[model samples]
Every structure is written in structure tokens, then in C-alpha cells.
Target chain A: MTDAVKISNRNFSVFYGAIQALRGITLDVLAHQILGIIGPAGSGKTALLRSMNRLNDLNPNCRVEGQILLDGEDIYQPEFDAVRLRKRVGMVFALPVPLPLSLFDNIVYGPRLSGIRARARLNELVERSLQAAFLWDEVKDRLQTSALRLSGGQQQRLCLARVLAMEPEVILLDEPCSGLDPISTSRIEEALMALKSKYTIVLVTNNTKQAARVADTTAFLLQGELVEVGPTDRIFTAPKDQRTNDYVSGRFG
Target chain B: MRIPPRNTQALAVTLLAGATGLTLAVLVFVIVFILGKGLPVISLGFLFDNPQEMGKAGGIFPTLVGTLILPLVAILIALPAGVGTAVYLSEYTGDNLATRIIRFGTDCLAGIPSIIFGLFGFIFFVTTLKMGWCILSGALTLAIMVLPTIIRTAEEAIRAVPAGYREVSCSLGATRWETVLKVVLPNALPGIVTGIMLSIGRCIGETAAVIFTAGASLRLPHSVFDSTRTMAVHFYILAREGISNENAYGTAAVLILSVLLVNSLSYWMMNRFIARRTK
Candidate 1:
């Protein structure tokens, strides 16, 4: 994993209407490594991930009070176009949300939105993205088939492929395998491991063991506050914070 | 004196079944009553030949043409505006006072009587505009009458599109308009079409508004500016004037059949479109 800081959150906070979801979170996600955010329910993990790409801006009640920098530039600046930023920073939601379209159409939605209308170019993207997400072989022959027909795990991976098609520099996953079988989860983990060399990945998950297994760096959040973020090995084995230690040791979520 | 759970369940089931049966019976009875009295009067000659002697002796060819042109023109005028309003209200305008007022306005418009709309069309399009009871005046009136139906149904349809689809589209860098156009609208198509179908039915059956504006001219309409007689108006004049009960029934049958044809055709097209996506 590279030691370069791809993203830096400098005392960021988020509010949904009147409720504070994240409170002064500061962290760095290094390039070419999976940064796993492990937290229990309502710990602001999703809020943090979504805010990076300004997906949270859709909510009329959403408000933010901090800066998240991408490659030394603050993304929250008024001049920073959220639409263009989303193209660079793709996201995979917690549940698989395959659009009611063919597999080919779903993968090319981002590309089409970005004005890549060449037929050959879209076809190439469909193949390569599905391959990168480890879904090409299973669905290679049925690209025109409806995406909703795919199994839950395959659908989630297809969602990942949809992001890949955008050729994004950063890939954010919010509990990508929260509802997957062990084999499916392992397959996703394997794909992520293989993908990190070319993409900066941030994985938000409830499973601590998943973080321990795949993440090079791990951050634990407790009730909307970041307890600590460190190397996964150190965070899991020798954390300096007593709360982190207790949480890692399964004392309580 | 609390009833036992099993007995209550059975009683509830019986009552629900009886209510359903009664509803179905009423619907069937109305359809049968109309078709039974109307079917014997229909003939190919009656359909193709132009009316003679104030709709006493020939076919309703002119009225059929009017029926086709009037609804077509009205739908063309209202569909874009209604759908635009629906999309803007649902996707662009957040929950605010303006949106609420617009929604309430649509509801009020929907609640207004067809006779009232006829009066407005007569006063506004026919008299004030000096359009003189032509197809344009009638169609404009019908368009206003159907706008609320199309807007309300299209809004419901657009809102029914899963919130997740919008999120996915936005996250993939789609602009609000792009998301609405590509994702939300296509998924909402079946519902929008259903709303359109309902509007078409209302336009085909509407007598009050069309009579007030279009002026029951038995002559075939040459253009939007030409005053014409629609199927409903022809039927009303025939039955009311006691011109020919036989011809009136024939027009009624033709009206029923055309509405059915349009409805089934739209449904078939919609089903095929939906099937293609699923496959």
C-alpha cells in the first residue's frame, strides 16, 4: 500500500436536518489501499462516505460544517461541481440497486451520462468493468438480460462494475457485503484486494473481522465519533485507545 | 359480548366477498345494459356513411372524424404540459408552500364539474377568443379539463419510481434533469400511459364541454378551426331530438368500441415495452 494521502478529512461534521450524524471526524485514506471503516449502527460511517462525493447534498435538510479534501483540494468548496466530483469518486451502496435495465445498459449508464456514445467504446467498457468486478464470466453471455434477474451477490458486484465503468480514481463501498453469503463475501474481498493497486478504496462495514481480513488501515467509529484510525494490524492487535481495545475485543459495539 | 376470533374472521371474509361481488355486479350490469341496447343498431354502413337529415338516416362518419381529431389534438396539447408539471413538482420542487399550493390547485381543478368546464370553455375559448365553437376551442377546453388528471397520475407515477434508482443515477454523476429523464421517466412510463389512457376515455365520452365549444355541426371538420360534432354530441342530439333512436344507439356502440380499442392498443404497447425491459 502506498503511503500517499489520497483523501484527508480535516475536522468534518455532518447534520441531517437537526440531528448531528458525524462530529469532527479527521482521517486520511492512503492511496492504493483499502481503508475499512468499522462501526456499529448509526455511527456515521455511511454519512461520511456519502459526503465525500456530495451525494448527501440531495437531501434538503442535510448540512455540513467541515472540509473533506481530495488530493489536497477541499471538495466542499462552492466552485467544486458535485456532478463532476461524483464521476471521479464512485460509490457502491449498502444494498445492491440494479436499475431496471439490461446488464449492458446498467454498466454503461455512467459512461452514457458522461457522453461516451460510441457503440464500440461502450461495449468495451461493459466487458472490462464486469471483468474487474469479478462478474464478467458469470454474465458474459447475457449482457442484454435484465439486471434485476441476477442473484443478490451478483447484483451487488454488478453495482461495483457500474462504478468501475466510470473509471473513477476513488471507489467507496458502504457495506457492500452486508447481506451476502460467506463465499460471495470472500469473492468480493478478493476482487477488492486485486483492485486496490489501481484504485483508492474506502470500505464501510459493520463486520470488524472483514476489516481485519482485507483492510491495510482500519478506522473504528463509535456513536458518530471516530475512536481511532491506524494500521489494521496495530488497530486490531495493539490499539492505544482503551475504547478501541474494548470494541475490538467484543466487549460491546 | 366479544365475538370469537374465528367467527369474526369468517364474518369479515364474507362481508368483503359480498362487497366485491356487489361491485363486480354493478360494473357488469352497466356494461351489459349499454352493449345490449346498443349492439343491434351497429352496422358497417352505419359507421362509414355520413349522417342524413339531422342524424336520422345515415352513418356517423363526420362525428367519428371529430371524435378522433378532438381527442388527438387535446392530448397533444395537454400531455407535454401535464407531464412537465408533474416532473417539476415531484423532482425539482421540494416540499414547500408553492408545491403544496400547486398540488391543491390541481386537486381543486379535478373536483370542478365538467359542466363548469364547459361553461368556462364557452365563455373563454368560444366567445372571448372569438374562436367560434370550433375544434380548437373544444380541444383547448378538453385539454384544460384533462390536465389535472394527467398531472396527478404522472406525479404519482414519477414518485413511485424507487428512490434508490435516483440515488444510483446521481451517484454515477447524472444531473437532476438527466436522472429524471433517463431513470425516473422511463420507469414511470406505464403509469403515465395509464393516466393518458384515462384522459383519452374522458375526452371521447365528454359531451357537455365539446357541445358548448364545438357547436354540434354535423358537417365533417376540415381542420382545427372548423366546428364539428363529436360522437357524444351526435348521440345526445339524436336521442334528444328524437331523430333516430337506432342511430343514437349505433353512435353509442361505436363510441364504446373505439374507447376499448384505444385502451387495449395502448395496454398492448405498454406490455410489450415492459416485457422487452424485463427480458
Candidate 2:
């Protein structure tokens, strides 16, 4: 089998009630790589991330016209199940969002919904997923406690674990560590590194140093258009685009 | 911040004291008058015995039971259905025409006059269906009457839950149903329960609707099909019929006391549920 679990979008434009948000933008996501999308506020970074799982579909006024393919399968086909697609392409939000459930339920929730029900198996999956998210030790003794009771950092990790339990092929992180402390940020970076072996990681962040620290590939988005994308080292060290360099150097948004 | 001048502070304090004292005096006078007037006729026999010879009244047992039964039935039907509709509106339904219409309908339902509901119940459940004066008709009427309360309260509660919770569940690849069941409902439960309590209060106190639809049967209702008389209805009948002035006063007092007790109990239950969830 080919190594690529590729995602390609051709001339994709998005509109919200006649107000165009994303201009006709084309992009490709390579497999098994961390793709970092960097953008300022309202530059469409969040919108682009939301589009991958078709979460934008939840908004009645949102309209998207384009061809988006996942490994040669058209994701925008009328028959495509958004729910199933979301399961395959999981997302983590900027805020720490633990469900109003016990931590155990938080981790096992997706797996159970996907039809895994054996008690022993669920417990094991919960443990494994939490460990993968680097939160097992801090939360092991309090697995049955409400997930909301966890500290902010722990809640974010728990959210990551919850997503990991679904075993998605692609994981989307929308500023996952934006709300965390330095230690938690490092832990999240470590978890992302560990996760890259199993899932194609796509991240959106405002932190340039974080992108330099974890991303294998970096793409800068300015005013809803892709400004530049390349290997992270080249993008950070010697970029071909002045806008990309200016953004990294903090010249302007 | 610098303190106000002594005269200004004193004037403010006096004003506050005067207002509070006046309000307290009025409240106390009303309570004392009602109790003083009504207490004389309250007897064990009056509470425990069934109405004798068409409400010559040694008892209010049937009315008390009927009051409890109708409101309980209304709550039993309204709690889940109302909360479910609220969950759909708050968590599932996007801002669309249908959601807007449903919300508008609920709002309009909430404001409709209770007497109109009674007339409606009388026509639909009683005359059209030939159900007659029965607990079923009364309970159904009360259910519709209180539904708007339940839905509005439940909707507010569901809305109060932090959006982060839903987003987290969605991120976990959980379906919308799963998110609502596991995350949203549990968090909003206390609010929903509060709504039910409020609905129960309105249902129990409702005299006009139950009287028209349920009829004034002094017997204990064995089923929904049986006619019943709630405490409020009994109070109204006693006051209107004037079997004796003493009986009317006693029945009114009993009805008031029961309503107070039920409201307090509902408040206590709400606090307990909130504490349990937070703990």
C-alpha cells in the first residue's frame, strides 16, 4: 500500500450568508506529518480546521463549494456521513473541554459509541489512551471523578485521550496548548510526537516557537489564503516567502 | 472610598429601615389575619375525613390526594418530554426556522390564560373524547398548562451548561445523541428538576382548569378515568357553596398550607440535586 493518506482541496471557497470567509484556496496534507497552520485572528485558521471534520456543516448559513479528497475518496460527496467522517478525523479545541462526565467515561466515550463495549476491554483502552495522552499518572486514581474537576491542563490532556480512544487516522489540534502552562505545553508536545507515528497530525497555533518545536511541516495562512508551506526547518530558518518570514519574525499579522 | 457624611448615611439608613419595616408589617398582618381567621376550624377530622353530605365536610382526604395525583401525573408526563424538547432546542437544533417556530410556540403557550386552557380541556378531552369529568382529563389539562414552564426552565438550564462540554464530546468522535445524553443532560439536570418543581406548583394551585375538565367528584380517584377534586377546587367549591362559613375558611387554610409545604419540598429537592452533582 502507498504511504500517503493524502488530503487535497481544490479551489475550496467558504461563505457565511453571502459573506465569503475563505477565498478559493488549494492545499494538500501529506501523511504521517505534523502540518502546522499559523494565522492571525479571523484569517480562517479555525474555519479551515473545522472544515476538515465538516463541523462547519453544523452552521446553517455556512456554504462551501469545492472538491476535497481524502486518499482519493471525495469527502464532500452527498453520501458522506459527517458523523463517521468526524470519527475518522478527530479534533481538539483550543479550550480545555472535558465533558460533564467522569474521567473514565471521557476516555471510553468514543470507543463505546463506535461499538466497543466489553468492560475489561474498555478499561484497558481507557488506560492505554490516557497513557498515550500523558495523563495516566496524574489521573489514574481519580478516573471516576468528574472530568470537569480536573485542572485545566489535565482536562485538555483528558480531551486528547478521549479523542485518541476513537483511533482516528487524522487528528486535528486547534491551538491545543494555548491555554496550558509550560510543563503542560511540553507534555502536549511530547504526546503529539508520540501520536505522529499513528496519526497524521494537523495543528493550528499562534505560537511560532511551538510550531518550530513540534511541526514537521508549516503552513502560514493570512487573510484566508495559504501564504507558504514547506519543511519546518526551511520555513523557520530560511523561508522562500517574505510574508512567511515576516510573520515568523513578528513583523505584522 | 471616602465615607458619606453622617447625615447622608443616617438618612439612607432610616429610609431603608422604614421601607423594610413597612413591608414586614404588611406581610405579617396578612399572614396573621389569614391564620387567625382560618385556624379556628382546622381539626384532625377536617384534614382526614371525606366530605360529608355534599361537602358539609368532616374531611379533605380525597381532595388532597387528587391534588397530589393530578400534579404528579402532569410532572410525570412533562418532565422527560419537556426536557427532551429543551435539549433538542438548546443542544441539537441549529438556529433554523423550525427551532424558531417551536420556541415561539412555547413562549406563546406559556402566556396563554389558564381559563382558556380549561375551556380547551373541557372541549377536547371531555366533550369531544367523551372522557367525562376524570382525573385523566384533569391531568392532561394540567400537563399542557405546565408544559411551557418545564420547557422554558429546561431550555435555560441546558443553555447554562458551558459550551466547552459539548465541544469536548464532539472532539471525542461521539455522536450528537451521545454528547447530549452523557454530557449535557447530567449537567443541566438540576435546572430541569427546578422547572418540574415550578410546573408542579402551577399545576397544584390550578383550580379553574381541573374544575371544568375533571369535575367535582368528592371520591378518591382510582385511575385516570375517574373524576377527582383537588384541594384548590375543593376550596373554591366550599367558598362558593357556603355549606358553612367555618368549613370554607378551614379548607382554604388547608389548601394554602399544602401549597407552601410542596413548594418548600421542591426547593429542598432542587438544592439536594445541585449539591449531589457538584460534589
The weakest ten consecutive residues by lDDT in model 2 chain B span B270-279
TM-score attained by model 2: 0.90
Q: Can you write out model 2's per-residue Cα lDDT over A1-253, one digit (the tens) per residue? A: 3247477777887888988788877888888889888978888888888888888876778999887787778888999887888889999999877766678877887898889999999999999999999999998998878777889999889888988888898899999999899999999999999988888989999898899999988988888888888889999989888989898988986
lDDT of 1 at B71: 95
| Per-model TM against the reference | 0.98, 0.90
Best by the lDDT measure: 1
Candidate that would win on TM-score: 1
lDDT of each: 0.94, 0.85
What tens digits encode model 2's per-residue C-alpha lDDT throughout B162-250? 87777766766667888788778878877887788778878888989999999989988889899999878887887787776677677
Q: Residue-wise lDDT of candidate 1 within A1-253, one digit each (tens)? A: 4899999999999999889999999999999999999988899999999998999999989999989999999999999999999999999999999999999999999999999999999999999999999999999999999999999999999999999999999999999999999998998999999999999999999899999999999999988899999999999999999989998898888
Give lDDT: candidate 1, residue B139. 92
TM-score of chain B of each: 0.96, 0.87
**True contacts preserved, each candidate?**
0.94, 0.47
lDDT of 1 at B276: 87
- Backbone clashes under 3 angstroms, per model: 0, 1
